[model samples]
Target: MPKKTEYVLRLYVTGASPNSIKAINNIKSICEIYLAGKYALEIVDIYQEAEVAKKEQIIALPLLIKKFPLPEKRLIGDMSETEKVLKGLGLQS
Candidate 1:
């Protein structure tokens, strides 16, 4: 069988803020339900990794970057909207 396409996701957020926490939970839930074992998620706290944030050029507090599978995409928000998140991740039409 062919291997499933693996997704690489990087979530950048500030320290423990409400929006950051919400974005984490929301993205996790989405990944569990949709991406399942086919995704690698990396959460980066700008406070702890300022250099990473600088390198990534993150201007927003809560940002989700789909780094793998080509055509990299970015979404910025708390990620409360499931449909929007799904669409952003290329899981929905």
Candidate 2:
């Protein structure tokens, strides 16, 4: 049988604003608790790398984009909605 692939998660944030901080922190906590050593995460600060944001077509701050494992997904805002994020990322039942 073929093997199942894991996820490559990338978070694009505008800056160190409160929303961005929350999103980063929440995602990191989730990844550590759930994803752990199986996933790779990159926090891209759009304020420092505006080109990255433009390339990703990010229209908002605190955007979390799941890049790998096929069928990419995006979550906006502070990532305060943990269950929703987990569900959308295929990390929850």
Candidate 3:
């Protein structure tokens, strides 16, 4: 049997702005529905952790990074578009 893929996600945001909140909610919903207990999600507020942003080279306000399962992927936006976000995260075609 094939091993189930585990997801390691990192979300970079700018404080509690609406866009950031939306991104968080959207990703959380996606994780719960799709990843369901097989994922690790870390939220980094660039406003608080400037160093992390610099290290990650985050150029967008709301950024999502899939760090595990090989071939790292990144998506930028509020994450409100479920289809696009899923596609970006390789959850959908």
Candidate 4:
């Protein structure tokens, strides 16, 4: 049997803004439902980690980056749309 794919996700947010909170909730829900135990999620607050944000070249708030499993993908917004987020994460065709 093939090993399950492990996803590495990084979410860059700006403080505790509503959009950032929403994004965090949405992504956490998505990962729980979809990726489950096969994913690693890191939430980074740009306000607290300015250097990390600058190094990542983050120009938008509530950004989700899928850094593993190849062909890195980025999505920006509150991540309320499940289908869109799934597609961006390569979980859907």
lDDT string for model 2 (1-93, tens) is 543338788898867799989999999998888886778888988889878766889998788889987789988888888899898789886
User: Mind sharing the TM-score for model 1?
Assistant: 0.91
Expressed as tens digits, the lDDT of each residue in 1-93 for candidate 3 is 554559999999988899999999999999999898789899988888888877888898799999997799999999999999899889899
Model 1 accuracy (lDDT, Cα): 0.92
TM-score of each: 0.91, 0.87, 0.90, 0.91
Error of 3 at 67 (Å): 0.2
- Reference-based TM-score, model 2: 0.87
Task: Write the residue-wise lDDT of candidate 4 on 1-93 in tens digits.
Answer: 554659999999988999999999999999999998889899988998789877888998899999997899999999999999999999999
For residues 18-60, what per-residue lDDT tens digits would candidate 1 score against the true structure?
A: 9999999999999999998889899988899889877888898
Give the Cα error of residue 6 in candidate 1, in Å.
0.9
Instruction: Give the Cα lDDT of each candidate.
Output: 0.92, 0.84, 0.90, 0.92
Ten-residue segment with the worst summed lDDT in candidate 4? 1-10
Off by over 4 Å in 3: 1-5
